[model samples]
Target: MKVLSKSISLFVVCLIVITIWWIGTDGFTGFTQETARVNKLIEEKPMIMPITLEDSKGRMYTFHELKGRRLFLTFIYTSCGTVCPQLEKNMQQVYESLPREILDEKIMFLTISFDPDRDTVEVLDTYRQYFGSDGETWRMARIANKLELKELLDAFGVIVLPDRYGGFTHNSAFYYVDENGRLTNVLDYKDIEGAQAFLHNELLGSEMK
Candidate 1:
């Protein structure tokens, strides 16, 4: 009887652990950092707040101005030696994989910097150039003011915190917004193939020839 009870208790504990892990990792699809993906499904109404940004060239753009156009947006800091470079590379890959028709009129790629104080217009422009960014296809920018920057980051679920190394530690992902300025999806930047498929199908419906 004692042996049977111990076995039953062990089985129950194992089952509980498995259940917790499954929920935390989205059924083993990914980890809890995938809140953006999980949130999309649960979000009854998706919306974006009014925000303004200054591009690498010192040009201003706002939510109102960018309406009626789908946007592929990401956040980064030019000084980042690790994750940011990979994110930009992922952006470049996605941009190149796009069709001219979509690039010309359907969508825009916006890379906004969360590190405004350190990333000036000149600095951002230089960074963009280093990445071989075509100004029209990809416009890197910084929020004009602190208030709007916080709002934008919070709304998109991006968390930026200073690290011990006098740098930042923040969550990174590809934030996808629809024409009406509502966030429709958020994908991991490392998932290059998924990003391409999502962008193509969402914009062109059928793949370009």
Candidate 2:
């Protein structure tokens, strides 16, 4: 009877472990289940983050104000002088790939500064001009409220860490939001070709409807 009891306890422990693993891996999808689950969640129920934003032009607006326009959004801190500049340049190429006339109204490129205290309205405006952005179609904005900034970053999975050089080390990615304002996809920062292709298919092929 002791032998049977011991066997049952071991089985129960193993079953518990398996259950934990299964849940962690989202039904055993993969070892990197966090990414898999996030992708799945975005596809199934894309999120809409409601946060107030102030543009470099000193214009304040809520995220809901951008509804009915497709957005290619990303985060940046102007002082970086390296990663942030490259990200802007790369996005510029993708921005130029599309027709200028079709931009700003239907589709927009928004770069939000996580460090609003340092990257003031004037700072962001100056930084954007370095990359030839007209400030209308390709906008630079910031979240002045620190509390709201944290919430927005967490919602979008953007990780920003302070560096020894008084700058930030943050993940770079283009977050694509559809016309309905739902964050549908997150593309890698270096994927220039993929970004262009998505724009072409999304705008050139189906923009009219």
Compared with the true structure, all predictions reach lDDT values of 0.84, 0.85
Weakest 10 consecutive residues, lDDT, candidate 1?
36-45
lDDT of 2: 0.85
lDDT leader: 2
Candidate 2, residues 128-168: lDDT per residue as tens digits?
99887888898999999999999988787777999898999
Output the lDDT of residue 32, model 2.
69
Return the clash pairs for model 1, or none. Answer: none
C-alpha positional error of residue 209 in candidate 1 after TM-score superposition, expressed in Å? 16
TM-score of each: 0.82, 0.81
Q: What's the CA error at residue 26 for candidate 2, in Å? A: 6.0
lDDT tens digits, residues 1-209, model 1? Answer: 99999999999999999999888776777666656344643363367777888887788878778888888989998889889999999988998899888887889898999999999999988999877687777889999699999988877778899898868888898888888888888887999999999998998884354
Which ranges in model 2 have alpha carbons more than 4 Å from their true place?
A: 1-41
